[model samples]
Target: MMPLDNRRLLRSIVKLTEKPDVRAFELALLATLTEIVSAKTIRLCKIHESAKPPSQKVVVDVRVSDEEPLGDDASLPTLLIDDAAFLECLAKEEKVVASIGLGPGVRIVHPVKAESKMVGFLVIECEADIPRDQELVSIMLGFYKNYVSLLTHTQRDKLTGLLNGTTFDDKLLKIITAQRVGKMRASDGKGLYYLAMLDIDHFKAVNDKFGHLYGDEVLLLFGRVMVDTFRDSDLLFRVGGEEFVVVLRDVDLAQAVAILDRFRLAIERYPFPQIGKLTTSIGATIISGEDLPASIIDRADKALYYGKNNGRNQLWIYENLIAEGKLKVAKDDSSVELF
Candidate 1:
């Protein structure tokens, strides 16, 4: 049988794999690490490398003080930028250990790779030199990296790299719960969730004419456009060929319309490798807390189909269509007629 210390250590490492979400994993990582290393502060920093000077969002941070933790930090400035070490770490493809300015605390930043890409950094702050526990930190992070790759493999679409259909239901449930809580938004008098369902206009024709090679390429490029267009907070998913879903987080009707239409326009103007250009039709609706996933999907589908039926490349919001008397939905619940 394994010894008591060995068992406890193994259990801590195994705890890392239990979390299915990348976000929750951040907090879990720090919590588990703190058990072993007596650090002053450790941060799981996610770098938005796409932005100028690169914005940093500390997903999880621990500090030995009675001060506020870094929430949404401001974008790094040109003159006071801290991108050098992160960039250097990413460039050199290795850990960059440094000493805190005029302090005994040692800072260690390691590259976090997931699905064969450098996603972010794991920063450790400790009293003693970090090299002493470098090997242990490396091993723990190796487990983290592998689990992330596996998680993404299960969640992402094979062709597009957008989220696969299997994970949408779980995400939808969480969205409903978050909306129901309505903590920050409740007081602010703003922020609502919108779900958009879209389809590639005449995607069958593209596949029919160009064959699956370019069809696959188009799907791949479509995913790239979504990544470029949507904020990191927004959820993007490919629910099978030509059919996609987007959950626009915390936006008003106007913002939802603007962004959805912008995405449609972007898709319409995107130049395909051999196909020249392509367009998409979108259907969307405001998500209500009481609405079930099936009901929300139904509303979005009605809005989406109306667009395809009318033209082929447009955005339609379900509530707007109903308000305009252009469409009607059944009151299956038999409470009060919503239409």
Candidate 2:
């Protein structure tokens, strides 16, 4: 964060207010931070940790630079994360403005948190360290933090913190438009995206046997597994009950199948408290730009039900099953409006 001018600040607040969802909100925040800084470049770096973040490298989620933008892999943190900077930032209480001396000038480190847990750092470097920069950073980020909490609360399910069903249609529509699914396999971008429906096998039994507390724990742990297993770009939602959705960004059919099955295996291996072990059945299909949200969900749901009908804990793909004659291409305007 940097010194926020009144007019620039007003515009930043307005821009942030206009974003429809978190992804757009993030990019907008990046743009705002960049605009106010008056620097040659600025980036909104996000740390996506694995099971553990301590040893892992940070992911620069978005950037604005003087040169060509950071390509996906090219955006890996050149920030002095290995030394004290990143760890110190993460450790500090939120709103406690701190700076690590690195890269051309003093870089201000502001910890961004969600639900009291540190999510990432907001790093901005300005050549001239103004007297009130830290106070401004604290004020700017404090507003950001509080609004982020409110927006997150609205967007995510109270139980799982996965995007709620209300967000599904908007999210699905965004991806469908971005990929332009049916008309063309978009260039440079993976032409098609995979949408998968996941259900916990006999989840009702878990609740019945262990009670809702344990069942809720299982769902939470399951949500964590989904987070750890998928890329940040992928969209995840808890549509209803034990059912969930994962939109695999820009991956092909084979990769989608492998990834979904890998998650199934991960669930199977997990020891769920008194429940001991649990598994998930997954069904998925390639998204088509021409398809309605209902139609796309219907395809994935069909595959999911097919897997449930065949076996309790397995993964199935719509096209693969259709090719094998285990499933049929949907006809007769058969579509499920899940959300």
Candidate 3:
């Protein structure tokens, strides 16, 4: 293959940096690199979280033509992660890190660092050894790192590194809205939906017991558990301290109850450290056409209050209260529960 024309490559790199997204930048760079150097595949791995002492590992994004599947290791070859020798060479060699004749093909691993930090890695695979002189590769990678950082911020919770509360809220709304719109024609039911609010049984206990640092850990861990337990379509939100909300779209009372039961059981089974065995009180409501988000939330809150007053670690549906006359027919100060 003809050597990559350095001047033209620089111009192309400038154009590629104009892409607005990390994936787009990766694809463009991979394509450009393939055209210039005749490489088989290009992968960009970006690592977001690392273990203590900083692993400096990155997870790659792969883009390839119809050659091979880019394979499993394309994104991030862990040989790059735990391998101190390979990394040291890349940092000091000022030359391409290559593996020739020993593997399926030549593996050229290049580190993409920004602001003196190893932000990600770019791996180029080809049939032969690749030379260094990576000015275009460096330029393209700089843009990619910035773009990935932005994408990470947009997708992650600023406090907990989970999906942001707003992002979850949006997703919940979408799923609920779709279910409501689609269920209009279902045979078993129409216009039935569910939503629930969850509040830590006594999150204040954590703050008092272990201080706010541990309290923060509890909240973060709580968010992680919620995300893990719920369906990807189910919306989970940390709307406030010790409070979360989930929308159960296209669900009847039984289904909604079952879903909440599962989450409640999961929480009850999982013992939280420092906080000990923790439980949550959940209030859920089925939505009607007359219901707005605020009203739906109010119903859930009422159910939550019922659970807290009667007992914690249980799912309380609004209909049960209405049937038992525990809740007022209309808003009035005089009808409030004495308990």
Candidate 4:
């Protein structure tokens, strides 16, 4: 590999911090890493945890070569983190270099830590070790850690730690774009995205009866339940007071409905200290290929209204309601200005 210019590398590092969002920052980091190390393949794998019945273990979320084009034929490499070498690297929480296959190459795994917590690992494949590669990688990882901290603070809600409302537009738009371009797909080969609106039932009564402080506690506890109930890959946002949104990637109507119902049941059964038990209402819709963010959200919001109006503590699917003539189809108007 040709030597990387120090001046050029510094410029790339500066650009990393200037990225508009986390996704952009991640892509920039991968591009810079490829240029710096002349790597064949690089992957960032994050640990996603689910704490529901059947007690699942750490599920790996992998992002590979984001710079590559996404077409009908484009497919990201499937990641298998169950391998012995990968498990050992994760256990040690340190750099691990190993030869995995018959090919004349080596794989390097470096633990990625943020805010004193081990969040994920970076894996790179290269033909041979470059001089001072570990040092360079460490410095790059440090920049990532700092940038991620800042991004997290800005994008997440202070009370709930879920994504703030301001970040929802960008994330939903990006997800829609990825789906349109065939960059993301479910295991079933159907590239589907489901948007759902969730709101705590009779939340105003809770606030009135127990006071604002107790209401806040309910919100906090509910957020924790969401984290445990939803998959790590699903995008979750606290968009408004006692209201949340989740975008289910790669899941059809049945799967999405099942997941939302599970969350509702969990909330109903949960004991909230003095509050005893509480319930939630949900409205969901499958995102169509040409649907705009606002339109998709409007549909879900309508469905949520249907659930709340008919009865509290229920889940309603917009298409299902439409099929039954209970709800009319929402007009698709992307030209309207959204503020």
Candidate 5:
């Protein structure tokens, strides 16, 4: 095969950078790779190193085929970190091409690293190898890694590294809009989105007693706990101060409550340095079809406030509060900005 024109390759790189979100970026990368290598299949697998036991490895975050549309599920195949071939690539910090029994063609797996950390991998399966394919893939992935770093820096909180307050509004809006358009429907006959707000109980007292530095440590540790407790698909945000928000997708009230309660218990059990015990108050509400971003946040915030005022270290559901006449439903007014 002849070499790809340098001008055309530069144009494709520019186009890939145009994608605003990680999902779009993955799809764009797959398309570009398919064209460059004439690949039969391409997939972007996100490595979940934090998952337990055999599952502590890679999951197919997105798969784009010349044969079919992108798949939604991540369960297509789970790549173990302990696998010899995978470990070889990781240890060497380089791309490794190998043959698998699942298909006839050779597969090239390129590690996608950001800030010197392995975030994911790009796998391409093709029958014929183009000249300088590895070099081209490395160049393209470099652009991807840089763009992702920039995007993450802008969207994340400087202190906690969770999604910041500015990004929360847009994320919440997108989730609500997806639900309305039937793009994000729940499978279990439950609500499509669950918005929850969490606050550290007696946070001000912590700063007063333990000094600001120790207080910051508490917040940092809390954020790490949240990351470990929640699924990767769930959007976790540190909107401000000791407060955080989680937007859970496709889960019922029971499931959502259970998840939040589990986190709360974990927080309680964790021993913060110098601090004997710490607890969090949580309030959550289902994202309704007619609800706007601000409205959903307001509901969750109200529930969180209820938990804080009534008893520290407890969880409250907004719908239950409304049914019990403990909280009043706010009229949905699109013009209002609750944040």
Candidate 6:
């Protein structure tokens, strides 16, 4: 049978990590290599420099059935090489590194590097009897280097280069779940969290008058604003269309309002190309423990509607409805307009 081709596989690896999920990208890389070399097992590891014992090494083990040829069971070399020796060789500042036949199988190691520094490593291996193909190794190593380069491009926003909308949502949900379960480190203080929804005032009008291209420019500008206004710890998602949501963990009603107010005024004061008198409306609410993600969003949307109605370019805290005597608990969806 013809052996795997390195040049073509390197190109494929370049395309793979361009995907949103890096883990998925790595898995695909191993799977492709497995086909070429007829190997058995692939284990990718991210060894952190500062981690303690078990916590330091984050390992992703991908196993293909032995019935399958060239799965994770191939005879690849393992890196029983000392940590210091491995780190020292990697200090040569190479992106792709490999070792063969130390453990039960032959193995390949690729460093995940961003901005010229090694962040982690990817390792793939196979059982003892499997012959390690030199051509395949060359191909896999080069492919891995290209994959790391693609990861840098794929994980960021096309414009602002913050995490893209979909990525942000995935990361946000993970953070929320982690914090809720105490898997994450707690912040200095605590209370009901808050979600603020912000919409650019007269956004459609700008698009209509200035053209869709400029409207995109406006959205990108607004994203920059959000990045500047919120803390690094805060989570923001461009939910859809012209709407963005900010989740502030451990924030109470009053703090939520103040933060939203600043965002509102920032939009109002900022100037843009071809668009004058820019402004935004904000709706915010303290998220309760009983609330689901949708419920929290709905409450914020209701408050946003109130802001738009009262006058655009303002902030409204949902909890203020009861205090102002303008709202009552409703049996149906009467309290807030969904759209």
Q: Give stretches of model 6 more than 4 Å off.
A: 1-160, 168-172, 183-192, 332-339
lDDT on C-alpha atoms for all candidate structures: 0.74, 0.72, 0.65, 0.76, 0.77, 0.61
What clash count goes with each model?
Answer: 0, 1, 5, 0, 0, 28
Q: Look at candidate 6 and tell me the lDDT of residue 306.
A: 81
Tens digits of per-residue lDDT for model 6, 1-339: 355466765666666656556556666766666666655554554433222332223222333211111223433222324444345435554433344636555454545454456555545454533335545555565656666567746655666545566765565455455445543322433444677888888889998999989998998888888877775335566766688778775555667667778877778888887886798888887655344556767788888888788888888777787567565557685454322
Model 4 pairs whose backbones collide: none
Candidates in order, TM-scores: namely 0.84, 0.82, 0.53, 0.84, 0.87, 0.54
Please report the TM-score between candidate 4 and the true structure: 0.84
**Candidate 1 — which pairs collide?**
none
lDDT of 2: 0.72
lDDT tens digits, residue span 147-247, model 2: 77778887998998888998887778866665452345545445357889999999999999889999999999999999888765567899999999998
- The collision pairs in model 5 are none
lDDT of 4 at 254: 79
Q: Which stretches of candidate 2 lie over 4 Å from their true place?
A: 1-15, 63-73, 76-84, 92-106, 181-191, 330-339
Q: On a 0 to 100 scale, what is the lDDT of residue 271 in model 3? A: 76
Question: In model 1, where do residues sit more than 4 Å from their true spots?
Answer: 1-5, 47-82, 98-104, 183-189, 331-339
Model 3, span 1-339: residue lDDT tens = 566666887777787767654456667777777667656766665444334233454343444211111244434235344655346545663335566555677666667664456655666677766345355566566666676567657655666655566655555454446545544433565325567888888789879978999888878877777766765335466776788877765566787888888988888888788667888899998755444556677788989988888878988888778777777656662233522
- Model 1 poorest ten-residue lDDT run: 61-70
Each prediction's Cα RMSD? Answer: 5.2, 5.0, 9.3, 4.8, 4.3, 11.1
If the candidates were sorted by their TM-score against the true structure, best first, what order would they fall in?
5, 4, 1, 2, 6, 3
